[model samples]
Target: MLNFVDWLASTSGSIALRESLYMYPWIESAHVLFIAIFFGTLLFVDLRLTGYGFKNLSISQMNSKILPLTIIGFILMITTGLLLFYALPIRNYHNLFFRIKLFLMLLAGLNAWHFHRTMNRQGKAWDKNSFIPFWMKASATISLVLWGLVIISGRMIAYNWFDCDKQPQSELVNFLISCTVDPEIYEYLNGI
Candidate 1:
């Protein structure tokens, strides 16, 4: 299974689509720009949920307006992110920070999805309540924190704090490589 995942990661269109010179960087830049927009819009929405600001607009109405921008940003982000990852799947596959970023991204998405579902189920109690629910606040806080971590983790990947070839073995690295490839990449490196 590990071998399969690694092969898939290497074979994915993200890596293959950007063999052209300079294109990878261009796509990566676009990915970063879109991520900025996504996070900015998310910050606005989350802050509103937590009663930080945006007083005049109803949450539903605000959601309607900004949701389109968010979706657009997501499209740009996912497309370019995949491309960038594909551009160097092996490098990313073995990076500890990259694995952490991916985990946070999944959690962030689930948190957002759960928040949307709960809001839909509520009967205007949120609008009437003077204080936001503690759970909602927690979710919003987690969203922000996770996203910040995602960005930080991504940036950290470029630093080569410990190249896969130089790092010691651990369950975390073993698990991450299994997500996208064989353990041999790390095993071969850590063995030395």
Candidate 2:
């Protein structure tokens, strides 16, 4: 699996992205911008759901108004994020912060899924009520925390503090990330 990832990382598309003077930075900027839009909209909706703010609009109405923008932002973010990942698949796949970000993202997705499945099924029963159910509030809180952590982890990926290449080879970081470092890639990174 690691070998295949390394191979993909070395592909033409990846190489092109790495070699391009502006493509990588532009894509990264897009990723960050989209993330801001996505998370910002999400925060508003979640805050309304938790009865913290946006009390003027009902929960259903708030969701309806903001969900489209959130989806759009999410789509754009994912697209740019994938391109960025392709540019250095092996480095990202082995990074602890990247792994944590992925995990948090998965949790956030599941939380959203569960919220939609359960709370949304109740129609407008609690939509107009400022006092949302405990479960809904908990879900909203969890989403906020998970998304915040995801952003932090994503930012940490650019730092070499805990990067795989900077760690001791014998450390268990590889096993934790579920990927081994390719020798050539290791040597290349070390030589830099």
Q: Highest lDDT: give the candidate number.
A: 2
Model 1: ten consecutive residues of lowest lDDT: 173-182
TM-score of each model, in listed order: 0.79, 0.87
Q: lDDT of model 1 at residue 30?
A: 87
TM-score, structure 1 vs. true = 0.79
lDDT of all predictions: 0.76, 0.85
Candidate 1: Cα lDDT at 116: 79
lDDT of 1 by residue, 44-126 (tens): 88787777778687777667778789889988898888767766776677777888899999999999899878888872777
For candidate 1, the lDDT comes to: 0.76
Q: Candidate 2 local accuracy as lDDT? A: 0.85
Model 2 residue runs over 4 Å out of place are 128-130, 167-170, 178-192
Winning model by TM-score? 2
